[model samples]
Every structure is written in C-alpha cells, then in structure tokens.
Target chain A: MSQYIPRKLTRLPADYCFPAEGDVAAYLFSEEAVIAVEVALVTQRPLLVAGPPGCGKSRLAETVAAVLQWNFLHQTITSRSRVEQLTVDVDHLRRLNDAQRAARPEARTKARALERDEEYYNPGIFWWAFNPTSASRRGLPANVGRPRVAARCGGVVRRPDNQPQHTVLLIDEIDKAEPDLPNDLLEPLDRRSFGLPDGRTLTADPAQELLTIITTNRERELPQAFLRRCVSLLLREPERDGLIAIARVHEPKVAPELIERIADRMVELRQQRVDSGQRSPGTSEFLDAVRTCHDLAISVDSEKWQQVERATLLKPMVAQDEPSRRP
Target chain B: MSPAGGRRGEIHLGELISALAGLDCDDAAQAATIAACLGFGLRAPDLAATGAATPAIYDHNRALPPPAARRSAIPHPPGLALPASSPAVEALPAQIVPSQLASVGVLPSTDSSAAPAWLVAGYQRLASERSSPPRQTLFPERAARGVLTAALARWRPGDAGADLDLDALVRCIVRRRLPQCLPRLPSMTLDNGCQLLLDYSESMVPWWEDLRELARQVSGVLGAERTSIFDFAASPAGARRWRADREAIETWQPEPGRPILVATDFGIRGEPPCDLRGSGWPAFVDRCAARDCPLLILIPWSRFFWPKNLGLHPQLVHWHPATSAALLRRQRGLGHRTAR
Candidate 1:
C-alpha cells in the first residue's frame, strides 16, 4: 500500500497569530530568518544560527516547532555537557544494584530482570523522537498524540505507528561546549542515527526528517566541517520596522505611537553607542524599556518618561551622574 | 606475576580497576580480584586472608609501600579492593597529567596575585637604568643594545630600575639617521628563544589570516624551532592558546629569561578598557609580573588611538609597522653582540 504524505509543508503567514503562552510564540521573524528556516525544512538539514545574545536565536526553533505542530525538545549546551547526554543515558548504578540483588538467594522476589532492562535506560529526547510509539506511550503531557504501536517485541520494545510526525531539536549555545564538540556531532548529524549501548541504532525515519536548530553566540568559532553541513544565517540588529514588530509582539497592548517612539529612540541610542565605540543595547533592552513604559503609564513626550528612560536605558553609573556642568 | 615488576605498571593497573568500578562494571569485583592477583602478585589465599580479616587490617595497610619495596615480600599487596579513599592512590605528577599535557601554554602560577619581592625590586632597577635621558651618543648601536638588555633583564625577578622613556630614545635615534637606518631586511637567523602569541578573538577575525601569515614570516626569520607561535583570545582567564595547526606547539611555561612577543589589534570588543579600575587588567598585569617575562606588543592600529598603560613592567615594549623594522634591527643587533 502506498503511504500518504502531505505534498506541501505549511508556510507561516506574515502576520500569523501566536498563542497567548510561551515566549517563542510571541517572536517575530524577519524575512531573512523566515527564508533560512524554510531552506532548513526543505533540505532536511540543521539550521545554524549565529547572532548576538538575546536576538531570538534560541526562540526560532520553538517558533518553528509550535507553528508546524512538531514535538519540541531543547538542550542547553554548557562546558560540562557531554555528547552522550543528547542521545541516551543508561543508569549503570541502578543496573549494578539490580545485579547485586540478583546474586542474593533471599532477594529473589525483588530480583526480576525486567527491573534492570529497559527501565534502567532513561531515554533522551532523541530516543522518544525517533520512536514515536515510545513517545506516545510515555504520554508526554505537553505533546498531542496517542499510542498506536506498529510493531512490538515483548513489553519493552516497540516501533512507531504509521502516523508520521516530526521532531525539532534545539541545541542552544553550542559554542559553549569544548572546541571539538561541533566536530563530534558530525557522524550523528550526517547519518541521522546514533548507536545505543544495547546495539540498537536509533535512526530517524527518512520520511519524517528530524529538524535540528543550532544556536551560537560566536563565543568560539565552530569547526568549518560542521558549519558546511548546515544552512546558516546571521541575525543582525533589527531596524525601526523590525524593532516595532518585535516590540508589538511582546507588548501587544502598547500604543502604536509609543511603540514607534520607543523603537526610534532605541535605534538612535544604539547608533550613538556604536559611533562612540561602545557596546550598544540590544533587543532585550528595547523590550525592557517598552515594558517599563507600559507598566508605569508614562507618555513618550512627558517629563516623567525621560526619568523612566534614564532609569531603564542608561546603566546605573551613567544614570547616577549628571552631564558635566559648564565651568 | 612478580611483585618486583614496575611500580608504575601496578599503579596504572590499580587506576584502571578503580575506573572500571566507577563505571559500575558488571564484572568489576572479578576484575578487581584479577588485577590484585596479576598486577600485585597476590595469591588467592592472600586475598582470602585479607577478606577474612577485620576492618583494622584495612586501616593498618592503608598507604601503599614505596616503589623501592616492590621486590620485598609483603603479607598483603594492598590491592584487594579498589581503595575508596582518594589519597591512597599516588597523585599523578604535573608533567604526566592528561589535562596538563593537553594544554599548550604555560599554566599560570597558583599565586598569580603576589609578585615576588625580588621581581618588583629587579623591575625598579631596570627601570632606573633605562630612565637616564638618552645622551647624544656617537655609538647608537651600542646604546640600542644597552636599552634592549635593560628592558629584557628587568623582566626577571630581583631586579630594580626607574621609569625611562625608552621609546623616545629609539625614536630619537631612528629619526636622526633616517637614510642610514633604512637597510635591506635582514636574512633569516636564529634568535634568542622567543614565543610569538597572536590575538585571534572575534574582533580580530578580519585580520586573523594576515596576522597568522605575519607570524609565519616572523617564525621563519627567527629559527623555526627557536620561535614558538601561539594564538590567544581575551577569554575570562586572560588569554588561552589557540591551536590552528595539527602539530601542537610544545607546552612551555613563560620564564623570566624568555622573550614573549605578542601581535594584537588591541581592539578587544565586549571587554572593558584595560586601564579601567576593577577590570581584568590587574589580573593580566599580575600574570605577566608573576612570570617576569619580557613582552613586545605589535599593534596594527594607528598610534593616535592606541590604548595606554598596558602594564607597568619595564620589559614591556610596544611596536607598530612604522617603527617595528627599526626595533627588529635593534633586537637583532643585540643578538649579534651576545653571540660575539
């Protein structure tokens, strides 16, 4: 029988309405960012996003997952994060305890092999994503799905049912890990499969390609080999229109005139900082200022608004001091 | 298995056993027993005796006997089970530690903040010697060598000198004989051992390749073997070695005697100015002072906007393209005199 697959993937509308909950839903994607995401989906390649901190690099994956109704899994990369943590983590200690119990004649009742078998292996997100039946049976409260096992071996082993669903894995701040980490991911990423301790190869179904989104702050340069495999986009600081869209998404109730005024001021401030060789404020700061204005009920043209701007926008040291008085 | 075999081998075997145990190996108990029998030359009966003995025996035989006593017969081999106490195992020497081996540059001294009293005194002396106003001398080459030695020597501990505007003297001499100073570039020759560290941070991206080429050229001019090259970033821990080549540079700790040349844009973005109080500047300054190593900074930027007070050390030298050729010649002249 021929399997049914959707011909065309859903494209997000220019003014798509996001859900009331979650930061990612409220994110506004620029045209370039949208193109990058679309290219990644078509090619079944990971999207490598390079940008400054707080520039929506991490949220892009969440936004994609939400819009496409795919299972979303996120892992923050740290200096101590091991590659194995991303795939499957077997609890050797529990297995050892079970083994010790099995050796005792008096503990036979508690020494069942089932206690130490698959239960000892806490499946990582990739494991659940690859085996949809396992994911459905596990009954992730957040995900929308029902268990319909296609194949089963004993109570512990199962494969996905006929329904095809995708998974979006967000590897955030990948540059935080060791220098060789990106290179280490080459094999798993290229083949879309990784080896398990139990000799099973967890392969992503080719028909339902797993979507990977990698975000980096450029703290360290990623290996050229790894970068070549993924579609990349650099998210630059937004202009006035982009800023207004971002602010509006986060603060929907904000007056249009106030949003415009705040965006213009932010752009001017950023440009001023850059011209003076100072570190400019980013989108995060802009959002903070907008939120402050909204909560305090300050008008853009009011004297009280200037105080709020100084308190929120200017750094503590700068805010405390007055401009040099004439001699 | 003989107890008289290499102590190192036995220690490594013990470590392997402990590692396997930590991984909760299913056969860890059996592996540990076998390791004791073969590596420590303990018979099954001796293990039985130890297992039967009270906990007091474990405490009494805690420390492993010295390596020299490998040939001596002992009642127990102290390898019955992997020692739970960490101190019982011999600590690996710094030279052989895996982490130490992986790192390419000098591990900063533990006491980074406290510069030795002698080092401070030595710097004062060298600073004083070079502080003398450059007298109009007939022998500019001799004066240049004297300045170079003073600068290099002050980098070592137990030295003292006053501040001297040595840059002014170099400029004065170079400007006086402009035509004569413009000599053809010197051929490649071995220098007094020096390491060239380049800045390869994000801000340096545009100039990274060019700087690396310059470093390669500098390496060729100085004997390749004598000149070690490294790249560093303005990470939290001052600068760390950046590896670009397959062959790792030999691990070396900067010492008082060695000359360390750094080529950087000095435009470290995302970092406060080096002169700012409570910034990372003190940590950097202390690191250099702790080693008492001479530094020659090569900056590509214009002098009009250069950062000031890089460090208070007398041995520190800043050079730009406009003045580096003259400085290089002066350095080479010092080398020639030392050789003669």
Candidate 2:
C-alpha cells in the first residue's frame, strides 16, 4: 500500500531548516550535493565537505538533520581541540575541586558520589550523537534511569513529535586542529563507538545509524587514511539565477529589481576577486547586500550604491580603478 | 596493445549508454545536444547525413592558461579553468536513436544549460581520469595520519605553551598545591611551523605537481600562515614568495628556529643525478645549520640517489609515495616520540 524509505532526502526542500529555535537559514541543495549526502548515508561513512568559506558546508549538516527529524549536535574544532575532547572528556578540574571539598568529614555523601567515575565523565558530541539516552546517564549502566532533562546538553535540534531515532553529528572545520587530532579520531569514527575514562566502551545503537558530517575549510591537507574513510563532496559557488533565488528567500520583502541588481553586483565583485586570486564574496555577503539595499533604499544607479558595495562586497581592499592610494 | 586493455576513451561510453533510457528519443535534437555537451563525437552513419559536426570535449572550466601566459620552458601549471569552447552547438536528429546512446553516469538534467557543459568538474572528473605520470605523489591527502607533520612539526618547537597539561593538573590536585595562575599549567607545544622552499626551475619540471602537492601536505599539518611557502629558482639562498600584503614577489628570509623544508633537486638533473658538489646548495645547508634551523630537503629522487657531499646536516627525504610519516620520523630522528 505504501512504498517509502524513512530518513531519505529525495529532493531539496524549499527551506531546509524549519520553525525551531534559531533555525531560519535557507539551503538550496544541488543535485551533486544530494548524491554525495546519499552516498555517505548508503556507505555508512562520514561526509567530508570541502568548499570555500561561507559556502554553507556547515549549514548542510543542520539541514540534513532537520529533514530527517534527527537530533543534531555539532563541535567546533579549534587549534587547541584534541581527539579526546571530541568523543568524551573527563572533567579533571571539576573532579579535583569536588575532591578537595569531599575530603572533609562534613561532605561524606558528596565524597561517596565523587567515587563513581561516571560523575566526572562529560559526553562529547560523538557520545551524544551515538546514544543520547546513554550519554544522558553519564556512562552509567543501563539499570540507571535516564537523567533529568536538565542533564540534556547544548546543541541546536528541532524536537520531533516522536521519540528521536537518529542523530547528525557535525565536526566543523576539522582542519583547524593539529594534524594528529584527525588521525586519532579515525578509530572512534570507524567503530561508531568510543571508550569512556571509566573503562566503558559505548557503541552506537545497532538500529540507529548515526550520520557524521565533517566540514573542513581546507586550511591544510587532511591525512590520506583519514580522508579515505570519508565520502567526499565539494560545494561550488551559486550561479546567477541561484543567487537571485537565494536573495529572494533570505529577504522576501525586498523588491525583485533591487534583488536582481544586488545579485549582479555581487557576481561582478566575485569575478574581480577571482581575477585577483582572492576569496570572492559568498551567499552571506549577497544576503547582506540585499538587506542593506532594502533598509537604506540604495538603488544600484545611485551614488550611495558604491558605498554599499564597498562595505558589503569588496571587503577590506579597494578596487584598483577606485582611487590612487589603492595602486 | 589491444584497445580494450591499453586504450581508454575520452568519455566513458557506458555512462552515456545508461543515460539513454531517461531521454526522449523522439526529440532527437535534444538528445544530440546532450551528447554534444558531453564531448561525444557521435559519427553515426545516419547522424552524418544531417551534416552535424562532431562535438569535441568543451573544457570551459579553464584547465589551461592563456596562450601568452604559457611558460613552456619552466613547465608552469596551466591553471585549473578548463580551456576553449569545443562543444558543437548544432544538434543532430539522425544520431538520436536510443540504440546508439549508452553510457553510465550521464550529467543530471538538473544542471542548467549555462553551467560548464562537461560531464563533471575537475574535482569529480573520475569519468575522464588522466593517466598518471611515472612518479605520482599524493596530492589531495598526504601521509597516513600526521607522519609528515610529526617529523617537521618537531624541530619548529612551538611556543613555551600548548593545551592544558592534564598530567600537571592531576599532579597539582593530588599534591594539594594550586598555582597562582591556572593558565600557567599548559603543556610544552609541539610544532613550530617551517619555511617551505619550493623549486619551480626547469629542472623540476617532472615534479612540479608533486611540489604543489608537497606544499599542500606541509600546509595541512602546519597552518598555512605558519608554513611560509616561497618559490625558489634553484638555491634557497635568494628565494622569492608573493607577499599578500605587498602584492609582489619579495625575497624569502628564513626565520631562526623555524624548521626549513626545501623541495629541490640540488640544481642537478640527469639519469644518475649528479651530487650537490659545486652548487650553492652546500652553502645554503651550512647557512641554515648556522641559524639553528633544522633543514629537511625533500628530493623527488629515489632513496640514496641524492648528493652525499652536503653532509648529514640537512635531513634528505625522498619525495615519493613510499615515504610515510613513520619513515619521515625515523629519518628526522624524531623517532623518540613516534607512535610507530
């Protein structure tokens, strides 16, 4: 009577993110992007998204989670971020603090609670994504009841009416961390399971297939072994019509003529940037231009348009033809 | 050699074949148009009757450089944009037979006509893969894990601080002694980014792509800003790198304590390459050693095939696929911390 597969994206939705807390961004997926995402899901491998900054590589993960009605969690990688921090981190400082206080005779109950390693174990993004129910209990045995809702951690997720079945874990700008971090991460990723400081190995639920999306700014080359495990995808810059559609979606009230003019100007500015071998203005800048035009009433032919262009599109450097000092 | 085993087509025919089922054979013009954009030379006996010219591969992604900018002598890369409009705009009614059309992974019709008409972009050019050269080094990804980075990141010993020293914190907590400043308990950092000297001389024509890949690998482990990439003509004594702030090629002055990585052939290229005897490479090595800068020269030759005259001061690594992080660590004497 019915032929439908659950949690499969057939077409790009008009607005990928929905009516949730701070989920208002629009995402228009290209066919190639859809294929890459599908391949990753099918292969059970993490999707390594590579693209210029502001190309919505990060947004794609959030959108995918929303479309599938899956719980979404993300971790931002930085220079200081380590492999241990991604899966699970033992709060040594908190443990020490508690230890100092619990050493006193007055805090006998607190000292007993501190004895359990589960109290100090903080679940990382992977842990939360793999099994939120388990992570909520802080690596305690299944006999332990689910912790209070207050124990539920931070991350943007649109609550589904039904019980959540899957999670989309996004590790953003993976290349930002030291080269060792990624290689160290491969084991946990491949196993779909990780170890806790309390001598516990928590594996992903067999029924729930966790989708991990890893986005890199491509600041450096990720190692071969690490990359080999990933289903790769590259997001290209939006074309002329795509930009106009994106502008209309971002700023619906703006005049169509104004949106067209802003889009064209953005294209020209991007062309100039490409010619100079610099990063071109992306969709975010285009949206900013559209919003600025609507708010300031700056027409393309008007003198104020150049100022808007300089402020939103061209970035720091002035175009060579603009002035003498630029030379 | 037989055609099936030795030769490969410009476009994989199997991909085109599977695409025929989705097409409307009645609209022969549309099918032919698709075929043309796909770089297919459909010389059907019936198609030729329509006087339609065969479409060559339209590489509008600008894969080649401009004729005037071409530097044939130095083997300069011809930039990534595909070259010239080779796709025939004329459609063929005769070649529209479904029997003729058979290829796999055809271009999805969702692509606007305005997009590059090729089957796929260079990043996804698995359909038209170029035969690799004799010596192919990893480009997109280098090393297994962070071997290369581990070897080079060592000598450039980073600042006095790293991430929070968990061991120190645990010790302090057990000893019941707290430091004045919490942040002072950071660990000793590994990684002092290196200066990369890339040789773009005519002698390095064969390994130009490898050199580019080398830069990407080094920059990957060490942040691009930390890995100062400079273009060297031959010797690193007076190399030049484009300063983004200045928008000009400025002399590369190596910083002290920062490890130096030179991807050069010691200015000698032959069947059995001559050693770095008379070249200024010896002087360059000596100069780097004096600056307390650990030097690693990545030669695109086989192991033990480089000049032995320069002494053991500069760590020489064969820039080949066989080279791994473990090998790099052993070569650089960073084996003490090697996970292998």
Candidate 3:
C-alpha cells in the first residue's frame, strides 16, 4: 500500500497572517518547493532546506503552519544551544523560592500547600506539541484556561470537537549549531518521542506525526547519518517570475509593472555581484527596495531613486563602476 | 476573681487543654474539651480537671504587660527638625519677568534675517547634511553573504540544482572579503596552536596594512598565546620574528609541532623568492615536515589580482576579498593542505 494519504489543498484564509509577523501574509511557494514539502509530509520525515540567507527557508515553516492550521514552534539554533533546551527546562530558582516561602513561619497555609505542585516546571515546545493538556494542567501562564485542541489526521492538523493539536517545529539555522546536534536529533526524529530530563517520556500519537522543518545556510556540514533521516531540498534563488510573485506578496499595493522593474533590477544587481565575486542580494532586499520606492514615490529614473537603490539594493562604499544605463 | 473574668479564664484554660489533647491524637477527648471551652451548660468532669491542671494557660492573661507600661515601652521614631526660618527670596527685576519680557528674546523677531551669519550658515550646513544621504558601508556579514551567493554560481556542480556542500567555498570567500568590511577582528579560540608569518617585503606594500590586520584578526581567533607572528623578506636569510614597535630582523627558527601561516602576495622584488625555486623549496618543506609543523601559505591577493603561478606551491592558499578570521579558524585544516 502507498504511504501517501490524500490531503485536500486548503487555500489560506484571506485574513491569515503569519504567527511571527502579524502584518505579513504567506507568499506563494514555487512548484518545486511545494512538491518537496508534500513529499516530506507524506514520508513523515523532517524537511531539511538548504538555501542562501533570506531565501524564505525560515518562512517556509511559518507558511506551512499557517496553511495547515497547525501550531508553529520556532527555535533559532545557535552554537551554544543544547538539546535539553528543545525539550523542557525546570525552573530551579522559582522552585527554590517556593521552598523558602513554604519554610517561613508567617507564610499563608494555602500558599505552602501549592509549593509541592508542578507549577515550577517550565515546559518547552515539545512538551506542548506532544501533550497539550500538560500545559493547561500545570497552569502555565502561557496557557491559562482554554487549551489548544485540533485533530491530526494523516499528518495534517484539523479542528475537531476534542483532539490533540499538531505542531510544526522550525529548527532554523541548524548549521550554526554544533556538528553533533544534527546526529543527536536521530532518536527524536525517528521515534517522534523523546524523554525529558524529568524522566517523563513525550511520545507523539501514532495517528498524528509531528512535522519538523530544518533550515541551513550551509555554514557547516551536517553529519551524513542525520541527513539520511531527513528529506532535503535546496532552495535556490527563485527565477524572475517567482521573484516578482514574492515581491507582490510583500507589497501587493505597488504596481505590478513597478514591482517587475524592481525585481529585474535586483536580479541584474545580483548577477553583477556574482560576476564581481561578491555576495548577491536576496528576496528580502528586493522587497525592501520596492517598498521604499513605493513609499517615497521615487520613480526608477529619478536621481533620488539612485539613493534608494544604494541604500537597499547595493552594498555601500563599493563604487557602482558602471552606471545603470538601462532606459 | 470576678465572675465574668473567672469564666473567661476558665474558657482559655479549657481551649489550651483541648489543643494539647489534640496534639496527643485523642480526637474524642479533644472535641469534648473544646465543647466545654465554648461555655456550654454541659460541664464534663474531665474537662474541669484538665482546665484546672492547665492554669498556666490563664497565666498568659495575667502575664500581659499593663496597657500604660506597654504604651511607654513602644519606641517612637525620632522627630525631624524643621528649619527655624525661611530665607528671604531675592526677586528678579520686574522688567525681566515674563509679563514684562519685551526686552527678552523669547520670541522670534519680525525680521527673519536677524540671526547671526554664522548661525545661519551652521543651520544651512545642517540642512544640507540632512538632505544628503550618508555614505554606505556594507555590513561585514551582509557583504560576506553577497560574495558567497555570487560565488555560488562558480561552485554549482551541474544544472540539476541539487544541494551542494559549499562550506569550503563559503569559508574561502568569507575569509578573504570580511577583513575589508569588518572594522575589528572577531575573537575566537582554537584548539591547536599556530604561528602567523606575514610577508612584509616591498612588493606587498599595497596590501601590507590589510594583511597585518588579517594576521592580528587570525591571531585573536586562534588565540594570541598559541599563535606567533614573524616577517619574511624574499629569502630565508631575511626572515625574522615579529616584535611590537620594532623592525629588527633575527634568524628565523620554527616552533616544533605548531602550524605556521605565511601571509604574502607571492611577489618578490628584483628576484623570485629563494624558497620557490631549486632545492630551497624542497629543503624548506622537509624542515617543516621534520618538525611536524604544517606550513600554510596565505596569498593576500584578491581574485582579480591572482597570478597564473598561484597554484604552483603545494602549501599555498589564496585569499579572496571575502576572507574572515572565523572562516580561517574553521578552515585551518584545509589551509594545511595543498591549494587547488
């Protein structure tokens, strides 16, 4: 039997905004990246995305979560980040304070009774993704009364009368982490279950597999073993049409012609930088330049437009050896 | 004792007895004693006897300090002394007051050109500065990114667009270009000790300062204690250990078991470097091998200025415009290998 389950293509809600940035809406994904995401979903493996900086690698997870209506958990990987931080961390200081309060003679009787409770234990994203009620029961400040409930059916999270919510774990900048970190994720990625430092095992429901997306800028080489467990895709700089589409998503109010011109100029500038052995500008820079032009009402041929281009598109102090001669 | 006082004392005595009994785990007896302490008509024989035995509980009321004595014992905060008299205020002249401020220059004059010429000139200068855009100095990491992305085209293996490991290429570009954009060196610590030898000869005059800065950055990243610096001319005879604020040339000697980094433009004035030709190159390589020290040649020249014979040396590593100390520290092993 084929492992892939049929999932209806759900159009994003018109008013849907990414959880991280409430003002920005999800951008249209390229056909190739969409297929790669689908393959990752069907296989129930982490999607490892390799790309240049600001190429929408991190935003891919947020877009996916928004479209699927799944809870998004983002963690930016740094060199000092430890594996335990991804699971859970006990608030020892708070617990110690409680202990001290309990020993006080004038302490309230009720307050002393609650000192031994689990309120002092801080739950990480994995804890919430696996057992949503654990957060509600612990009376975590983040989740006070109402608990998040959604059903995970065939790797997609759907709203149900009463069911567990699925989560999308975004491991961003995985290359910045220690070499062993990718390998260390083997057990968690394979079993979809990890034991907390507190000795409690958090296992995902077999029916609803947790979706994970990892992004890398190719700063460091990830171990082969870890790569084997993931479905990887390289997100190259999109083609001209794709770049225009992205720009439109960022500034839909701008004229399409103007956006196209900006995108084309950005592409040319990137090519020039490439030829000169310099790094090329990414989609974010293109979006910024377009937005600045639109806000300032600066025409492409105007003198002030050159200032905007310099401020956003080109690196400073590097002489534009050749003037933009394009009419 | 008065009847009311006697009754109140008896109740207190009974309550204390009940607490003691409760501590002893006599639940039934404790409850009965509590009921008797409530002054109910029921007078249990055991309650009366317990109350009598616990006369010390009634002693609490007797031991209380008299109200007058307690009030006198209560400590009071020290009183703050107020100033004896307020100083007389010196009033400003009536003409200087806001109501009579016609002489004061609080408001703009009717004549717009009343301002001093220098003040007007300064305002004009400020306005001109504000109108003009500031010079752009690209962020080091951003510039590094630009170089890496551009270099990607060259590193791309085929049209399939499969994810390629560009870690080495990225290190090369970042190690070369970062020094130009970064004002200061990045601090890092390396496990293995190394020495940095810079080419300070005449031919490298153009890139001398930049190469020296790169060396200092590399030293900081690799750790200063473990990393040493030296200067070399065209020949081994011109090699000398680097001393701060000094140009004295001494006999060159290699530290055993430590890696050596030679930053140069690979150009020798008048004649080619002695080590690049004849048995001198082989002999130098043998000496480095004998001491178990890896020799890394860093050519601090941009890709545009790359010479045709750059790749001839087995230990030579060409520096690009995007080089950074972090990348150097990361690619130390590759630096030890032959430059391709």
Candidate 4:
C-alpha cells in the first residue's frame, strides 16, 4: 500500500544551497557555525562572517546549501559594492508566473492563483530561501485534472503548509564590500524580514530558517555592532596535519608517504620566521606548493623540493620583494 | 592651433567637425551627437586638459597580510561577557591598564576631543564612528594596524612623470562623477565640451597625497591634535620610524551612523570580469547594496583616458579636471598647480 502511493524518485529542480556537511564544519572552525546557521534559519537573519582571505569563508555558504539541498543564493562583495543593488531582481520571475496564471481559461484554475498567494515575488538568494513557494519541496502536479473535475475540485490542491524547512543565504567576501555595507545587515540579521517600500513584508519561511553566512578577507574592518551578533571564529593558517588533510581531499590518489613528506616540509618552512620574524606562509602558500609539486611530477623528498619552491613559492615572493628593495 | 578655438579654426562649425570626428554620432541633426561621441572617443580628458607636463604614476601601497593566529599570552579572559551592543565607542573607556596608558602619555582625564582626527575633515566625518578611537586604547596591536592602513591607503601609481592630464581624465571617467561635471566629447560643434577635458594626471600623485594629508589635517584640527609627519629616509635594514595617529586608521571601522568612502578604480584598464554577465561593476554595486553598506566607490583611475565601460553604472562619479584641480587647490601645502 505504501508503495502504491506515488513517491518522488528525484529531487524537484530546486536550487542547490549548501556545501557537503563535513566540509562546512571543517572550513568554518566552529560548532556555533551550524547553530548560527540554525539561528539564521529560524530568525531569517543575514549571517555575517569575518576572517582573512583564502580561509574558505565563501565556500562555507555553498556547503550549507549543498548539505541542506536548498537553493543557494550567492553575492560577492567588492570595493564598489553599493546599496539598492544587492539582491537580484526576482520580480521578473513573479511577473512571468503571474502572466502564466492569468492566461488560464477556467475560473476555478484562476481561483487557484488567488489561493496560493504571491509568495513567489521574493527575488534573489533571499527570495529563494525565504519565499514559501520556493521552499516547497513538492513539485507541480504532473497532470492537470479535466475541466469538469477541475470545476468540482477547484482546479488545484492547496497545501495548508507551504513553508520551506531549510534555506541557505550566502554573502561571500563581505569585507570587500563598501564599509557601510556590513553594518547595514544589523536590521535584516535581527528581524529576518526586510520591509519593501511597496508596503509588502518579505520574510523567510518560518519552518525553514534562513541560514545566512558572510565571509570577509579582513581587507577592511567591519563595524563592531555588526561583528558582535555572531559567534566569532577565526580560521588560522591550517597546520601541517590540516594541510595534509586538504591535499588528501583534493588528491586522494596521491600516496600517503608523499602527502606526509610534503606537509612536513611546508609546515617547517612556514613556521620559520625571519630575524624580524615576518616570513610566515599561509595555507594558500602551502597549497600552491602541493600543486607545483604535482605539476612537476616531483617526488616527496628534498631533491625535487627546490624545484617546487622555485616555481610555486619563492619566485612570486621574491618578485614582490624586489621593487620594495629600492633605496 | 588656438587653445580655445573650435576644430578646424571655425569655432561656429565646432559641432559639424565634432560630428564628423565621432564614430558614434548616429544622428546627423542631434545637438549632443558630437558631444557624446567626443566624450566617449577622447581617450584621456585629464591628459588632454594638461597641455604638456604629465604627472608621475606610482604603485599603490599594499596592505600587510593577516597575521597568523596564536595563543594570546592572556586569553580574552573568560569573565567578560560582552553585551549585544557595547557602549558607544567614545563612552567606552580604554581597556588598557593604567600603566600602559601612562606610558603612552595618555592622561586618564583626557577629554573626548583628545582623540585623533582623520587626514581629511570630510573623511573624518565620513568614517564610521566605530573607527574613531576612544579616549582609551583598547587593542594593544592597533598601532601597527593604524600605520599599515595609512601606508596602504597611501599606495598610488608610481611617479614616472606620466602626464597627469590623461591619467586624470581617465581617473575621472573611472571615478564616474556626473551632474557635478559631466564627461565631455570632442564634437565639431563650438560647444563640443572637449576643452573641459584638461589634463592633470602629472599632478595626480602629489594631488592625491596632498588631499589625503589635507583630510588628515582637517580632521586633526577639530580634534586638537597635531598631524605627525612620517619620513621615508631609512636604509633597507635600518629602523623605520612611523608616526601613527591612533585616532585615524586604528579607530576607523565602517559604521551605519557614518558614510563610507570606498575607493575603487577602473585601473589603467578594467579588471577582469567576475562572472559571465559582465559582473564587474554591477556585481560590486549590488553586493554592497544588499549588505546595507553605504558604499561610496571611488574610481581613482583608468589606464586609458577613455574607457568603453565608463557610463554603465549611474552612481559612479568620474574625477574631472575641475574636481581634481579643486582638490589640489584646497591642498596648497603641496604647491599644486592651478588650471591655466
């Protein structure tokens, strides 16, 4: 009997929202990361993230969406980021649906439109996550009822509960945004609803909390009021073990001996400080070394290490250092 | 050629000559056809504005990379549970110990006005309140950060004696200023508006520094603090001395209560497009708007005098010869030249 009931074999074509579950926690470096995700989910608050660049801050939002299987909304901030241009105009989608619904001939089919409401108007990533219709896991019915049956049954089956259970909102590299931008999230972060001047209140669906996350490279400092809302987690340069783990994730076929050998040397060099103590290498620097070694097909031992160092690490740094050496 | 004469020496036929010159003059009878074409066609209004002398270009200063995380000698001691909203930055006392404050020559009774001001008064006002230093310094590492920020902001193109006029014109369009002083096109018409494209790029490096210093001074005057001059006389390994205004770079966090002055440039050429839909400028604008940042993007310059992408975003303001001249004039200490 259970088998007789039609079941969805495939996920309806919804937006892919999160990154894989294991990756987010690893990248984010906090338990509160998920809880903050939950808070963003429940309260519909915009997530604010801060950290140095190359820390995988932007990737966390995508991981959340992939884990949850919801729509992923992404916006990357830059020095030129401005107000009134943040969200994509989802109004066009609403208008398209409206026109489609309007063209229906039957009064009862038209009545279905009135019943569902304009939850579709929410646009952008926020709209995808917060709009109830967007969050509805159920796809549109496969077959339309006959006109006589539609008249009797009112053309559409209206679900009493249409709220989304999950949504991921990703604001990437928020620090790159103009200075005023990060603090501006206070209201949206707190209320989970932004009031459109058009007299309509757009809200994240209550059942599915709006999971918002922001990332920054610390190019500029964000306002404290904006920073205080979330649990602050710093993603330091990954240690030797972490770099090994990252290399394994990217190149599973690479031998463990090779991975361990590469990680050990990279870690040792990174730990070395100049007399002034300023020669620290970042996770990015380490990763570049790994890629360089792989491209050169160099073995893990010291003989080929110089080639990796020359190609990936030393040249760029020396080139950068050359001009500043001027008297 | 007369500096002020219309094209071909027929001042009255300026529009006709401009029309013939501009490739985008679609309509033969349109009044602004020549102007629009010349505006888009002339590569560097600033360079054109300057008759001969070019300003030097300098490489923009790079910010120091983020420091690695380490265990603090004294961790953020567990007892301090910060409230949802901390006290206003000014109302909050310096968390530094009394000895440290004394060592720094800060008196416990220092007035609120004792805080240092920005390099520019307008910039000071535009800086979010959080960026303003409190009477007491809370973070010990702030001094280094302050110096780092100032140095980074001071980075500009090299002073290669490139003509500032073209650079200035390019910078103007890249900055995207409009309504105040619109961009000019070189139409044949007597009023083609190309004359307004005076070159000032040669003076840009000094102009930029003067402006930054002026801003620092203006903010300093209001706060009763004297601006300290930083010197660059050190040898490669010699001890470099930096004078940081604890009030400026250290305290300047972007705040809602204050306007943000975001400096952006189109570069000598535009940056690589971010996404498929020409996300370069539009993406930047949208993201800032979405995050609620009151962004003021400053297109400091363009590699070419004229760029095809100049008119895309409306909020942009291109730095005009008049504007650069005005800014230079205001900073007279730099001995900036006036428009002839």
TM-score of each: 0.46, 0.66, 0.46, 0.40
CA RMSD, predictions in order: 34.2, 17.7, 36.9, 27.8
lDDT of each: 0.53, 0.64, 0.53, 0.39
- What CAPRI class is candidate 4? incorrect
Quality of model 2 by C-alpha lDDT? 0.64
Candidate with best lDDT: 2
Positional deviation of B306 in candidate 4, in angstroms? Answer: 40
Q: Give the count of colliding residue pairs in each prediction.
A: 17, 20, 17, 92
List ranges where model 1 is wrong by over 4 Å: A1-11, A14-24, A100-105, A114-118, A134-162, A300-327, B1-340
Identify the leading candidate in terms of DockQ.
2
In model 1 chain B, the worst 10-residue window by lDDT is: B48-57
List, for all models, the DockQ compared with the true complex.
Answer: 0.01, 0.19, 0.01, 0.01
Model 2 chain B weakest lDDT span, ten residues long: B47-56
Q: What is the TM-score of chain B alone in each candidate?
A: 0.37, 0.50, 0.35, 0.23
Question: After best superposition, candidate 1 residue B90: deviation in angstroms?
Answer: 76
Chain A TM per prediction: 0.78, 0.87, 0.79, 0.63
- Model 3: which docking level applies? incorrect
